[model samples]
Target: MTDIASFRLLQPLSRRALLGSAAAAGALIVLHPFAARAQANQAHLRIMETTDIHVNVMPYDYYADKPNDTMGLARTASIIGAIRAEAGNSMLIDNGDLLQGNPMGDYMAYEKGMKEGDLHPVMKAMNLLGYDAGTLGNHEFNYGLDFMFNVMQGANYPVVCANLTRGQLASDPKNDDLFFKPFIIIEKTIRDGTGAESPVKVGFIGFVPPPIMVWDAKNLEGKAMTRDIVEAARAWIPAMKEAGADIVIALSHSGIDAAAHTDRMENASLHLAGVDGIDAIFTGHQHLVFPGPKTWDGMAGVDPVRGTLMGKPAVMGGFWGSHMGLIDLLLEKDGKSWKIADFTTEARPIYHRNEDRKIVADVASDTRVEDSVKAEHEATLAYVRTPVGKTSAPLYSYFALVADDPSVQIVSNAQTWYIREMLRETEYRDYPILSAAAPFKAGGRGGADYYTDVAAGAIAIKNVADLYLYPNTVQAVLVTGAEVKDWLEMSAGMFNQVEPGASDAALLNADFPSYNYDVIDGVTYRIDLSQPAMFDKEGQRVSDGEGRIIDLMFDGKPIDPEQRFVVATNNYRAGGGGKFPGIAGDKVIFAAPDTNRDVIVRYIIDQGTINPSADGNWSFAPLKDTSVVFSSGPKGRQYVGDIKGVAIEPAGDGADGFALYRVKL
Candidate 1:
């Protein structure tokens, strides 16, 4: 077994002290600059990262019910095996969120019942590939503590997380909650650039967002909670170096969006990189790839071209195994200690989406991983494929952004039904209930074929899973009609600011996550493209000017500003996941412990046959003589005849084969 290094309490770290220690850490990395040239006892080692696997053990899409080349750790194993074969020394590590995401993970927890002796498919696959060390992602807590512990108990490798420990108050400055180890040091032999073998002590410390306590409060309340990631790093990193670790790699489950160098930031990787002792950082939680063109646009302190974070190598392996983050390091022996000489980063993909939208696969499904977890994989397939209910019309999200989509409609219907039933016994039953749902399978970065397509007929569990990808629980928040307007205005951020009349004007704001573009049922409104967004991505209002929302009405009348209404949404949104207005606080009136997927399934089963069609509750405010262009999957061509509202026609091919459409108002 590899050696485990317990984080001994050196000193308690206050918020101010953590910041001061972070300053000191930054100084250390700068003073110990990367050495130049090939010196005595030098070598090259490749660090392989498979982050946000999300329990996709097989090279298959459980939601799509087909073989997927882009996702799954099994496909990633082919990359790891090849990279390791070409390197003198290498370490394969995961960046967390391996426990849950899709139906297979759901099946393992709900149906298969992770018994005492049962091994999780993710654990089986990782063991077969020989993972060095790993950490937990936020999704790991979705199924609650017992289930998470059951999954981790089957692991053959050590998984560390500085935050999220059992039996401790998350609010305490210093607490003894050592349910899991904070860090681990691996002893490995690597040849220096001079081709001389030397021993290296590689230290690994993990961090998850402190917001997990709020995100998964049902599962984690009074059981496990997260501390501030930056604070945890400050307390543990210096201690790791003191424990004789040659190099420290931060397995941060946070993203790199934190421009402010402060504690408790959700995306704290940027701040963590500024710390002195961290040699490199591997991040996830945003499901975006570092050193990629998508994130290179004006991000501070990130050298996307070179894949460096604060002059140190960093990577965020594309989520769901779409890409494997690789960091090749050149190490040299300085006296007896190993120091980084040079390094490079690239998020290598299992398949490439060419400019022409062709999927060029790098390798086939890994037989080793497949065979290792063949039993569990097969069981999950059968569970999701089992027929649950029926649909009268085809359900797809091809033009979800441009039109009211049936895919999101079904989700809203489910939430609305669940909320109405739950509120019947309460005094709030008189209030109007509005359901908010977003298209999770809309074709975007997942490629042109990523959109959900369920033919009119028997709907399976897999089809329902496609409609709602996350395991978020149902929640109802009470907001005034004015707050509701602000909420809709925030969702309008998905569209780009448009001129009154221009040829081929861009429509979609590529920065705003499509998942946050919630279409609220039980209301009628129009998005005005001519106006700039009032709210930014962080839900902060940039202007009080006339917002894009026009003709906001409920029950065929203009909503009164002071009127009260109940809005149904998932726990993530209600807990301030997108920073939407009037959410995540005392305003939340109802919290249902059932996963939204279960609610969807129950709705489907309750309704013998779903009327799969959007209610046409919202549309874009007509911009006379103006045409806006937006992109959707090429599969959208099959459904343009069914879309309502403004006339939409195919313009041409878009990036990654996303069918470009011109909406002539």
Candidate 2:
């Protein structure tokens, strides 16, 4: 069963505040003395995990410039001490994606470079929390190797990864020149039921998604390579066993997918769990949770209620410090080795939504974690608050999935403008330039409060960063009209097929990531929800039926299959991210050095007072007597009247505090 446990620390922060600023230099707070004893031959071990923290040291949102209850290491840190007091032996670990995500990460990389002896703010916070170990996630390679290496030097704990190689692979996966230590054997003292103390060796092996080769190709094309998650596990688990590890745990940065295992698959946690010698697993990189009601409902070999994958204990903490994954294990002595006799897993939240749809923090912020990075947090606030330009219309992504949106339109406009100017003096200047942009925050796994909402006023660096998330550089690709049509067909998989007369059928495919729902702005088309999707979520052709994209037009004429066009996109897509059709390294015509966010900032500055109204380049085709339902943040209700060419009304409350809306097509 899902074993979520919550215990309040009485006046955790208030005591520190009462002591005033003098407490900053005082001794660190300890929840309980580590003097508890367990029964002989059996022990209780609690494994705590924090994944995808993404540089959120304080309980604040840099984009909105306000305190947020949902995400922050400080909030998660409040319960760490209390959680440790419950078990005789405990280990706190991080499951990677620690380096980059929010504006603080951007500020550190761009504004404040990581020089020698300079510790990263996130690493400092994790060190203060006394993390035992951590692994590498795919996002760790985002800022390039030198910057990543500089940041890794600050980590106080052992960071291990079995799959990533520096230059080339050796003859065997075990012999590969690993970028980090393959696995570490952590020695610990365990207390048995008889109060007898003994030594136990816990081994942790780490693995990342193999697609980093494609996602960050610019930084990792020739300099690095990766082994498959399952392949690497099969090779290294034996070595860890021979190294005298009594119990083995796999820190898989990949997600859980029950699909048949293939080499280089992105979500291979289920397959990795089946490998021998792995006693338990910690999963992340999908920003999801195990033992949760939704997300993993009917997948084979995945028991959400029991929190098991292939019958092995597993947990995936929600991203951005929203949840802390805990796996409680009862270890029994079996001859020379320790076996997992029983276990209970949970993804505990730092905050909970009340009946009134407001967030109520379960635990107060841990003052020690907040104080560790106070200087960097303050500097990051100053950096993001610097004004860049102004916008005439509000930019939000509430209806981005259902209609053309201003938030995405602004990014598309900025990309098109930047690329047009970059290629104006080049040989390919006359080609028709189209920009493809997607909504990075559309309230999927990020929860209801994750959408981008910028008021129409003076915009700052944070607002521009919100307009275009990620640090991808601008890239222009040359593609034929046929490839463009297939591209749109691939993106159309975001919506689920609706029957012509069906009422309130689910509109969106929850598994489809919002980042892959690319909306090409220069072409106009209608998404026919009645038709079957030509491409699946993996960008593979799954049907031989009519495509969902209909009446495709460019310049008021039917697009020709032979006509070649220049598509302005980010390096992630041009380098084969999301497996888009006919878009890869060979098609890239111009790769600019400037980042996409920087280009947006430049565009806003050039326009001075910019207008970010969506031009309505795409829409849903009419299906008589059909109404589909979807959910967004409750704040979307106010902007429902601003939507064009569609009739949307409040349906009711949705699960997990989202407000459902019905759209008539």
Candidate 3:
């Protein structure tokens, strides 16, 4: 009943260079004009989506300072250009997260401040690509309204989002004071399967995660507000249909996770699809792809092979311009209004890791776009390269998980320093303070080289970028001692179950991301691997398990279960980016506008030379005659002697250029 598949060959197109510079005042390159109706009743409408780009426009990784094939819009431009050529009618649209994420974005905001008439590099690229419409994502507000509003002013295409509003009344589209237009109507000609052509009104309404109010509370507390995604969609979708929209597409800046933890859940793309009058949905925010075996195989309601959500076609282009999402519709003229007869969705990635672990370039970067932003890109490179401070010892995360690591320790120190200063002048000064940090560069899907290994001196902006990996603002969450134990239990879920006296048992859970493995710096605890994890990855309790986190203590005594503690964390975690219990929007007591990376930079500058030490806060409970096998970057071999609390040695090489090590529990 659905053609939500690309059974046909996904034509890999060479990215032809656009001759003109991408930075010029480029006119919108309209693809088949609506007034120029095609010659058939059954017309084709191909919708192209670039989701979660986060402002990476060029084919480069700023953190790595290398030619990256998997990221950047310039590379996807080739795929989009090829797809446009193959189709008779098509429109390019963005699925949000366009204005933030990259260090280049921070460079532009912090070093190269925006003026009244400045166009952001990513906005220019989207305009040059002839994007018909776009939406806003959660990261958009990270830089605040003035910066975002200034950037949005330069966009030639219409930007629409139904959820974000200035005030309570969202009834009248014109007078509602909505951040962007609620929906835009585009009249386009479609070539039906019957070889007939007609003009059909395709409407696009945008929705952002409702948690933005909490995530960007500093920027959005008074002036702006957000309604729940589903509620907002239901309210506007009916109006879109009544407004004579022939077919409607939901540009959801959300993800496909079916679990709704709250009434205003973060990832509600699936729920948004169930709303009436929405023909298709483009989802993002998780930075993951759909219609692939890895993410979609055997999921409920999702037809992975066909790329359908509840029988409706959906696609999520990978983040950082890694992939281009395409949805082709066969619209048959049902009298006056056109109805979708058939559709297929596919997410085409720019590069793939072959069996040999080599990253092959699937498409070349578009020079035209790169040329336009060439000056800005170079400026950003210099911006990141400028030295900030020095480190006494080399900072690396190769042994971060198995033992205390300076890489994670430095972040915790910076957070503790910043949070303590803030707490000193407040009523919360009486409560004890703790800092939580996770090693972001633990070398997973980004490859073995995707780890933090800063040499013992001269920390620059790029090094900070590698260390933190996000521009997340700092926040302090007030939690009871009981909740703190539960929180650590959730983070301890990163390890695999181990048996006593088991030889070479696997230690790490490959499915658990290193970023989710938060280590609390102020508390002494033991993670007993023999017991089951109390919480699953989604923060759902699998079982009321016993003592994974054992002997948790603070101030040289057992932690009082009833005592209150203020734990420092980033906005992403505090606002429920990770499904951790006891840390939600409501738990946040203090919100600092400074990003965690910036705090690290400031800490290093103030200290002159940072000495990162783990303070021996957390360790595993002893299990005699048992060893566990774990994998890390091959680079970990050099630091085996320095790791404490566990007897460790190199076992051998692991899959994908990693090293295997055995650690005595």
Candidate 4:
């Protein structure tokens, strides 16, 4: 979280006031020791959290196939050690997303294979660090239930997730308590002001996003069921409190939102805070840090930033080993009870800031962790390099978002092709198909050199992962014509609303994450930038809530609300990432048991040559006497010549150092 003034002390009260009111000054100084003692003896309960780890045990990014300094649990090892040394009492916990992300994870899953007693490398590293507990992230199910269970067996600590349960039974007879436990209680000694150790019981309850079973339906089918996060918390918290636990902490794998109540879209950290007896909440999945102390709406005395629930303390650590969350709570002895007197919360980054605004990694790799995964790393290098298939023509997504480009068309065609065969015996086999794919290699965050450059030749497995980095399996959600329109309106949230005839309007939304925008190519439509977005970044509807999609037509006709169509997308969106109407996971007609990256690879293999050209199936809304400007790097110069019906000219360099282009449409 950003630094706030509340944590820092102000210059000793105005000298004039001190001098004019000597009596009040003396009284303030007399009371200062109590406040100072409270701050000094504050039972600092340091909570170190890692989220969305995606199995990067080493300091590397396997998708980019490079040693990246920006992400890795190994790099953050020093910070974790230092933070633990500074705190009075510390607990290390991982908020899920640990199972799959890199080639290393894939290598372990497919090539090495998890044996019954084999220890997973990632789990071994986490064990060495002494993790107290962990929850399941959506990616944990990528390798299916059996694999997940086998991997968890390697963890030295309890794998806790209250929301997930086995099918048809309270326990799995084969390996009871192997995959997950509802909660865990740890007894620790806390030091009083006189340095006397007092016994304290800390309770941790873990919860994963309930939507995971829906998102990873192919893997979770008939194996497990997931309950909503808040509902699960409500059921579990009371029992946890009754179990004689003084402090209760939530390892929430769900996200925190500005919303006050629990909804299908909002994970409801606010609602979780309102629940009685919840002491502190450790949140994840959203990958954001709470900016400051925020009281739960309609709840008394709960401050999320101060790491307090119902006057207790809470924190949401930033993701990818970037930051470790710290929450310190001070308790006062009152007769036979220890009640919290004060608290503080901080999200500390692992990297240090340089004068040039660059983050410097300070930790050296833990040799034990590195040695454990050395064989796996070498195997992944070879596995990713293995040629999967040949692409007869260049497969580029330069125009994927603006036009019906072959890159997206290839993926769309592949999804439609895969679903048709998979659902031959299903009831929805006759449904019309539409595919939603986004420009994963889009310009932003990914520097100028980050675009896809797969030449017309043998494509390797690494290239496939590059094209689709996220571990999102293919899901086809059935929707009516009107819902389809709303879905498009939601996708339009990617662009900034440009005023009519405004030449310098920004093309993309700075705050709206680019990865979440899915460009549906099967239907013809136009984005009207003149209208505001239908929804904001938090999924809240735009103030006006009027449709932003203009002239939306399906099959050369105006959309028919009664007509139905199946739009193929990744599991994330179908599970609720977009919050688009009528497109939840329940609407899924078919979920391919393979990742979208795998499908793209198979598609490229089946089709020898991809021309990488747009079919002109979609275009912008009419721009009469209007000119718009956008920025792209020198690499994008090659494809700007392909935009139809637009007069394009080189404008100037953008503030970000990319070449700016002015287009008259």
Candidate 5:
């Protein structure tokens, strides 16, 4: 952690009083001249940010299915309080996705609808903390737009989005505002070292990913429209500068996109740096913390890529309020205006990463905040505990991707079935149906108990949440057979290219996130681990790759490029999530209001009894008599009975008692 005193403020205490206090304490006092000089000449602006909160307000991760001490905005509140104590001026902002993720959000949306004047539990908590501004995340529309606006009524702060637009209001005879105020200018007075007061104006502009319109089209259709984020920034930043903002900070809900590994713009911070008049940026949506200052390629004067935008400090606090982003700007008075002199950005985590390799909360949550939402939290627990469906067989994803597994197949089947019905009235009703479902129960970030373990019995609301944690609605996209092959090629990027002779550890990209690994189950194909990934993270082809997808067979026949197929997938993926080729939001033929979890529950109930068996539609290219070693959570231990052509050996504990299985395929 950086020393707090480096960015010192002018002492409000007088020299004589300081001397007297020092004499009273019998201690020698020394003051840095630089602090005094900076205090007299510079104004400091502090920005606090929260992103990807996913409504874990109480420090528990329902998705991890564990009591995580590291996360929760309540934990973040402690850091906010501390930062405020040290700074003369500060602003608190959230970057989006505050609406869903945990049972708290689900309970609120389903069990307790928002009353006319009633406040949302999370918004209520944020209001007490005095948030300056926030933007909408994609998940905000999960419960529907009306619910979002209803909950927003309780917020004390402005909910800003510069790209979203509303239609004309008939009663008002004028169009409602699209997005939010392009920017907000805030004026604050600060005391100097000599007991003099200085006035400063700070401007904030908010941006959300335009893709939300497609991701949540079911809820957003004909209500509002979205524009590209970068394009929107280009149009709005100039207007903010003209509006007399001494410092302009972008509250960007979009993550960075960089094609080159060398360029820092791969993260949103760096990308936003290219925008003019954006003096500082507080970025989120990627759920990553800026390690420290970094500079991007072809950028000069402390590029925002390195935590400084146009030489102004910027920071992205990690998600779930795990860390509070802090940027301290040293400004010099140029005539009547305060110009930035020097600045630095830092993210402080509420829970310190301890020597024991565990994150220990540095401070306790504000009792008042917890007390405010205690009732809602309890109500949510009760709601999630209720049984929603019954399953005759266990719904586990133990062999999901490794073999033809039924857990994922059931999900895929349900999604396709749902889409087919939904499109019955649409123009694309005759399209051949295909469903794309990934192994949500895969043992990765989800710990030992994270896998679905409802064993041939009752499936409760908790089980449903476990099966489908994200609040993604169902969507069907139309794509040709060739595009399907490309989509699978992109999905293959999830795996590390295994060299013929490399060890298992060498066959995985340690940095590659597990969520991006979407296993396409409806198609019969083989993943050639020996081949390099066709596309990179940005969806750019690694080579002039014509066909990374081999055998290209659908139902035991070569796929025709012109043959159109409607692939069923969750809203996230269908709306440019994995950056798969030819699967943009525009290609969507049908959108279902039901989430994948709900569909799964409905399917299980309708079936009465399920075999939970995979029909072996997809498999790996001949393992060539070679053995592959993999690890899975203990919850997967019970479902290892069906893996074929593999020698399964128990290889002791890996991550959180995730039993390692060495299989010779």
Candidate 6:
């Protein structure tokens, strides 16, 4: 992580801070250093972006099966009318990941098949909002090319993607036959000052991360390939300028990173912004907002306060239709070419927290947008509510970080059981089988309310989805005992180092996303918070001598470093999603066709009922007189007595509507 001296690693953007920012969410604050030079030929163009929508057409959480104020295109669409009225000319575009996320997307792909003429709910919603252009995200390929193309057929606007190709890649980007149109120059007429209408060719290019080939290797192994994000941008950008395009805007579905550009780097938006011909950029795929004070505040090459990346106007709309990214540009028509005179960027949120920390919808759902997908929305509700199986215990992820959680436990159990059955007759049957699972809803960016909580008995499809967020298939990897230990060491980065006698030190690393904190079942380990973490938040080994993982054992004995084990995990980890050590594509021995969620459902149904209890396989090592505080949802207070293997008590309230709990070691 970049050095952020003023920012605290303990507490993320608090509810009060979000509330403070909400005040400006309604205002169009110009962050440009100087005012635009007034001229008769000057035109103000507003570019609106909705990225990482993930098929959230309605303001509803399909997993929780409830209406949410923080998400949905309907809520975002409500603001577009007022925003368009505030600008001289406007264009709305989506960055990508619109095809799949919640049960609505799953229902369409699985139960209600998408044919040629059938309009997908998200596309229908965007079409109603009159989106000008869109691009494909990595998740768009989750259901395979055929389903993706069928859904894309419903999009009224042109969808372009520059990087993805049918098969082999050529030496140069231009020589490659792309799967979609590389770029499009939209010929639009903008009314300039003094009532003069002039022609403007605005070029929009799109790029997805190169790792889509690996992430979706099962579906895209021989069918598709990709070029680096910056490579594609470098080749296509100059061509766009050569093709009579005046202002080029990049709809990059990649996040910003200041690290030196490497081959096939996932987060390459910062480097893409440095490309010569690109004028403005809209970025996503990290599910984070740009110009936010918390995350990208002091990162190199990023000016969150000014909403600029590599000195160009840039914005990232938060995921799931939480916010709409806006870039207001002052364009000066100098004879034939148009130049950007001044600009402002903002990510207007759909909701905010009140003074009492209660979420309030800042914008109501646009009824027109909601009515467009009303049928599918109701069908999705019914689909997710379908009974899957039963659970003997209540499953929740509130204390997943500090304990072996049932939410993750059930997934790990299901995966291990499925993998064991699959490998029973295979050569790998001799190897001890373990399973790795993580808490997908442990209240990171989604805030205090974002956690999985299921009551005992009568589990539904939505509850299973709550347990497993991504649509990743199951994979079994052959790893040695040493690699497994190192993997747990990497996961230990989720906790902060504490002094021997420290009091009330923050325990959880707020920057470390909870999804990456893998808990491996069929093994026991202890995390020594007194020692420096062997790996950094980015999964890089920063400490060689000091280690956090201690007393790691498998099958009730000290594991041999050379002993091989079959570890069942999701395709994302097997394909190197979190950069875990010694686990990648080469190590994957078996790739199952079924998704992890499906496996969980099958496991639940086969058993009829499951205990769904955490086995207390891992815990923090003794730290003398040390106490650490961590935050979870306020509802976690009721389950504090159920937490095993750790001593914890209420520490009072926390920021962002979270309740604090002190873990005494």
Best by TM-score: 3
Give the lowest summed-lDDT range of ten residues in model 5. Answer: 10-19
Residues 1-665 of candidate 4: C-alpha lDDT, one tens digit per residue = 21111111111222111212233234221212222354433454556788877777887765557776556776555345445545566678888888786667878987789988998878877776778878878778888888888998888877788767676433322232224678887777776655666777788888777666555677877778766567767777777777767788888877655445544333656567667778777777765665344223344444544555545466767666766676666666665445566667777655556898875654445455677678877888887787656765566655444455556666677777776655655677787778887777766777665566677777777787557767677888888988888787777887777777776666767666656777676677777777888876666676475676777777788878889988888888887775765567578765554568766655665666444455566666766677777666566566667565445567787766566777665
TM-score, every prediction: 0.68, 0.68, 0.72, 0.68, 0.68, 0.70
TM-score of 6: 0.70
Off by over 4 Å in 3: 1-40, 169-175, 192-196, 260-262, 294-300, 388-403, 413-458, 465-519, 525-551, 560-613, 618-665
Clashes of 5: 6
Q: Which stretches of candidate 4 lie over 4 Å from their true place?
A: 1-42, 169-179, 258-268, 291-311, 334-337, 352-368, 389-392, 397-403, 410-451, 464-519, 525-552, 560-615, 619-665
TM-score of 3: 0.72
Residue 180 error, candidate 1, Å: 1.3
lDDT, candidates in the order shown: 0.79, 0.84, 0.80, 0.67, 0.67, 0.84
Error of 3 at 168 (Å): 3.5
The per-prediction CA RMSD against the true structure, in angstroms, equals 11.6, 10.6, 8.4, 9.9, 9.1, 10.1
The 10 consecutive residues of candidate 6 with the worst lDDT sum are 1-10
For model 5, what is the C-alpha lDDT against the true structure? 0.67
Per-residue lDDT tens digits for candidate 5, residues 236-319, read 777777777887878887655443223112134455667777777777766667534432345443454447644556677877
**Model 1: which ten-residue window has the lowest total lDDT?**
2-11
Model 1 scores what on Cα lDDT? 0.79
User: On a 0 to 100 scale, what is the lDDT of residue 190 in model 6?
Assistant: 86
| Number of the candidate with higher TM-score, 1 or 6 | 6
lDDT of 3 by residue, 283-393 (tens): 988777887775666656678789988889999988888888988887767788888877888887778788999888765666667887898999988977877678878
lDDT of 6 by residue, 79-122 (tens): 66655655677899999998877778878987898888888888
Error of 3 at 208 (Å): 1.7
